[model samples]
Target chain A: MRRGVLAVYQVLLLVLLFAAWHVLVKLEVLSAFFFGEPLQVLARIWEWFASGRIYPHLGITLLETLLAFVIGTLAGLVVGLWLALSDTASRLLDPYIKAVNSMPRVILAPIFAVWFGLGIWSKVVLGVTLVFFIVFFSVYHGVREVSPVLLANARMLGASKRQLLRHVYLPSATAWVFASLHAAVGMAFVGAVIGEYLGSAKGVGYLILQAEGVFDVNTVFAGVLVLTLCALVLDWIVTLAERRLLRWRPAGPGAAQS
Target chain B: MSPQPALALHRVSCRFDARGGGTYVAIEDVSLSVAEGEFVAIVGPTGCGKSTLLNVAAGLLAPTAGAVRVFGEPLLGLNRRAGYLFQTDALLPWRSVRDNVRLGLELRGETDADRLADDWLARVGLGGHGHKYPHELSGGMRKRVALAQTLALDPKMLLMDEPFSALDVQTRALMENELLALWSQDRKSVLFVTHDLEEAISLSDRVVVLSAGPASRPVGEFAIDLPRPRDVSEIRLQPRFVELEQTIWQALKREVLRTYQRAEA
Candidate 1:
């Protein structure tokens, strides 16, 4: 099938890329000190995994990402529904919401560190701050833009206010949230890594920081490689969840399909 | 015959705030009624506020003036005894066909919702498609699901706004025949609105024509004396049916021309 052929080409491309990188470094065309040797990076990753030294760091990062993504999405959904349904509230909060969303939210990591210390909570809070806005805007638009005909139809079917919220608002709102799942998850991962780099003794970001202090470029490359794999795992998990939850959507190049 | 009508809109006037400062009148001083178990179709020119009248009857829109009564009682909130069929796709895209059909009953706290939903799906000839989503089905099939969703509630009255206008000619005729078959079982008082004069004449016991808008009102009314168990495609070939169409088209044609002329001006 076409999909099978495409997969083979994808794997071939990755191999070609790695092979070219290995050959360039061995020929001294590229500086190993700056780029780091591909063999050493791969070996370093293998050693860390073989020794099981990277498990705690990887686990902590994933935990923070999960907690932040869940809390942020839930908060966004509830607040979005409230604002969309209440015209007065939305109008009153419009300017303030825009101002806060436009601010450089990553700058809050230092403040969070001061309040929550160098624990996991500070990183989680930073991740939550990053993930919240993406979900909030999506849900808000989704709820506000719900087809009026559907609302009228549900009303005609004897739907009470509570029933309307349960049957109509939540489902539509979640579609928008799910559509933006990738961006939110990526933001959470970035928040956790950045928060760790600023002030934390744990997580892969901390390991990379420690490696950089000693000019251990190979170790730094190894740490980044490990972190990249972890992100891939998280993204894969998100894709699985989106598939199960959004199966009703048409099959296309978006969420809600295989 | 019962003296009280099933639905009565008395001197209803709906005026909307225009884009600028002044008010725009949609339907002005329009009064209409549908007797119990009667099928009444309201035909009009484009933008003649035909849907505004239907929305008022359904209690989805409150008229700027006058009142709406249902079976002798003044409607306060949503008309609880009426089901609405919208012109556009109204089925919840996320829900399966059976779940969409069960939505109303579930909202009402009915315990046997699944059984009733399945039964209604069967009635609409979509029994095997209960597991499919709205987008997975054809346009006509989705409309059938919407019909099942509305009919499962078993409301005393039905308010349909050009429910079959979106389907193709063949599918539209098939849906019409199915609708007639369902309505004949126990004639629910129906207020069907459309711009298709042929569709209006074919499906209803009576047809009311509204003039072009700015302030639209009913300009004509005609009784359809076509016999029961009629096939919508076959009925158009009959001489009586043609005569009725010509008579109604005369009343409707001037309003249609007025709408076009105003648009060009």
Candidate 2:
């Protein structure tokens, strides 16, 4: 019940901030050219939605983020489990893994663009690179963190090799995966937008770049607002999933109701 | 002739390559056995290789030397006929209490795994708490869940490493009583390792004392000759129980001091 009230206030705070922005611009306290007119921003967004012009761009950005997240998470889980479980493999590849992970992976965006061209694939690949490491490191530590006692207990309980992976290893690793889900999803979105901002045929990021070129502050703000909402939605979805999947986790950061 | 012992370790040893330098011999030439339906406890000072021996019995760790035999068969890999109760919180936190109990049965392809899990849960005095997760339960409750999880498998032997060491005096005694009640039912061979001499004497048919680390091994053994269905708390007040403790403590005291002096050094 208190949360229900707090949620209303949260929306109220957003409205009050936007109202202050509108009133400030109306009184000439802030320049509409730079700060942008909130009303016009909302109108532009409505216009884009009404004409359905924003759908394909929104679709492309959303698709890129999603594809990157799924593929990257899977690749990270498989590779992380393999390397972590195998003493020889992790030792041999240790330095190379460190080198690749430490290198500024964002710099690879241009190369991905060249390889995949100015399409959704380039952005998706960029997002995957960003998401993969975050998840890979989490899974690596997670698999290693499987309490030796617990593993031994499972083995003594007659769990086969395949059963160990499914029951003991996968569940343990997924806890670490859920802990990093928000950051991974956020990075995926960042990768897609940064990829698009650098050069792309369509995406909300592309629209913002186009608006900035002509100095149309209203469209730029609209695009920013749209992307912000999308990020919030994705985070909400991650929270929901973490709640359901990690229900057994002691309530703390990941499973916090608030 | 008598039947083969349920578990036997002849001249077993464990040596670890210390992170800093030379091999650390945790235990060496440790020979022990638990006859069929016997409950044996190994007690020693803290840091003694009591747990290492238990691990060897569970087949979780390979002995550096010598051999481990289960029912006259040379053991290999994981012990197929034993259930191990770890000292630490070893339950899978992600699974519900019932699911944790159900996992072993399901792995063996039991179609009625859920029913069996519920039966074991009820047997462990946790009949209504099956839906609860490990983290949601109190420490004692979690221990009960672990007990249920281990016992549900119906293993021929149990390898317990200070399983109740973490519980408070009250909970520990309660669990000890429950364990005795259950063990009396089937009388599975038990190899329990602990530092508490009282706990060992109260729970086992025989108590073995280990010397301090750096080649810890059995230094003494005593048969309790305690009667059946003994109450752990009540048995302690008996004159015979006191007699056994005094006898074992004399031999065990020197080893405890050795461990202390080694630590001080």
Candidate 3:
């Protein structure tokens, strides 16, 4: 009953906040340029959509995020596996990898922009850098923690090196990969947004930057809402893929009902 | 009754590098052999290097001294003659029952994995559970899947490390019976490792007792001579089974004490 009441309360709070927001703008408690009326923000979104001003920028940002996510994930998987499998490589490069992972990667946006230009490539490189280390560490830890007893059993059963990788290492690493991807999605967005913020001439981030330059706080908030919506949608797709791939996971309440 | 030895270990010794200067011996001066189609069990206290010996036989571990051979070939370079059944079922949690059974066959590049896996799973009384994953099965069922997998390859030799130790008493008995029946179909040479004296006595043609570590060596070998088809119910009843169990226990008891003493030291 408490949960049900809380759910209703959440919706009521949202409505109340929007009402208060519109009232403040109408009463002149907030400036139109800085806060804007809620109705105006909604009107601007529809206007941008109808004029097709939003589509091209949205498309570019989406493409950059998707490409960077895939490239970063694949590169992380391969390198992580290689490092985990080789004792000498893991030992030699572990400290350097740790140092690089620990550093603030967002600070490299200007450097990436200079290297790859104000195009989508610079955003992709930045996104991949951010996503790669999180996934690499997860996959490496997953593979390393594989049960020795299982490995011994496989060896006794005549498993080849290739077979061991497929049967054991891959399955073990899969959980870690999924966990990393949830974080990676947000990082991908950050990479593209930061890239546009630093230099790009066109992107949702570019639109947000333009609005901010003119002190248009309402438009800045509008860009944030758009990005958040896109991230949630992408995260839903990833969750679906995870469900299909990891069916071996014990049936949850969802499966029980089905 | 004349055939080559299925496996032979000559003065096998395994040593691990310790944190200190001295070496830690897992096994030392251990010589053993199993004849073709014979079921031999090795019993020892914990830390007696029984697993180390099995690994050496499977060609996974290299002995610091001496050599292991399977079917007249040195185990050092051999790839696939031995089948190892771990203490845990070690079934791939992500795979279905049939897939777990098909794993070894798939690794060996056998194209007929589907049909073979079906047959083996049926043989283990898991005919309709082919699509169910390991997490969906019970402990005994998981071990059955592991057994079916090992048997699917038709290995020349089977090395089991406490394969039934994880099961409940009733399940263990049933598993032992299933194993005996499977062995009867085509008696592959088996080297089973266990700490259970009765288990070692109940299933083996011969039982080898080993001393406790840092350097465990064979203490004695007892040949089980009760009867053929080795009646599980009758074998327990036999005076010989109890005699062999007691004898092996007597050999193992001192080693168990020594192992504990060493730990405290």
lDDT of each: 0.91, 0.91, 0.87
Classified by CAPRI criteria, candidate 1 counts as high
Question: Model 2: per-residue lDDT, tens digit, B128-247?
Answer: 999989998998999999889889889999999899989999999999999999999999999999989999998999999999998999999899898878999999999999999999
Candidate 1 is scored at a TM of 0.97
lDDT of 2 by residue, A87-108 (tens): 9999999999899889897888
- Candidate 1 lDDT over residue span B96-164, tens digit each: 989999999998889999999999999999989999998899999999999999999998999999999
lDDT of 3 by residue, B1-265 (tens): 3366899899999999989888899999999999999999999998788888988887778889997877777876543777888887588778899988888788778899999999999999999999999988989999999999988999888999998888999998889989999999999999999998888888999999999887999999999886878757568878878777787788888888888998999
- Order the numbered candidates by TM-score, best leading: 1, 2, 3
lDDT by residue (tens digit), candidate 3, A1-258: 487897799889978998999999899998776787787676767777899999999999998999889999998999999999999999999899989899898899999999999899999999999989888999999899998877876666667788899888998888678878889999999998888889998899999999989888777777877899899899888888888888898877743321
Q: How far off is residue A44 in model 1, in Å?
A: 1.1
Clashes of each: 0, 0, 0
Top DockQ prediction, candidate number: 2
Quality of model 1 by C-alpha lDDT = 0.91
- iRMSD of all candidate structures: 0.7, 0.7, 2.0
Model 3 chain A poorest 10 in a row by lDDT: A249-258
lDDT of 1 by residue, A1-258 (tens): 588898899899988988998899889999888888888989999998899998999889888888998998889889989999999999999999999999998898999999999999999999988889899999999999999988888888888888889989999998888877778888888989999999999998898899999888999989877777777777788788877887888887664232
Q: What is the DockQ of each candidate?
A: 0.84, 0.86, 0.60
Candidate 1 collision pairs? none
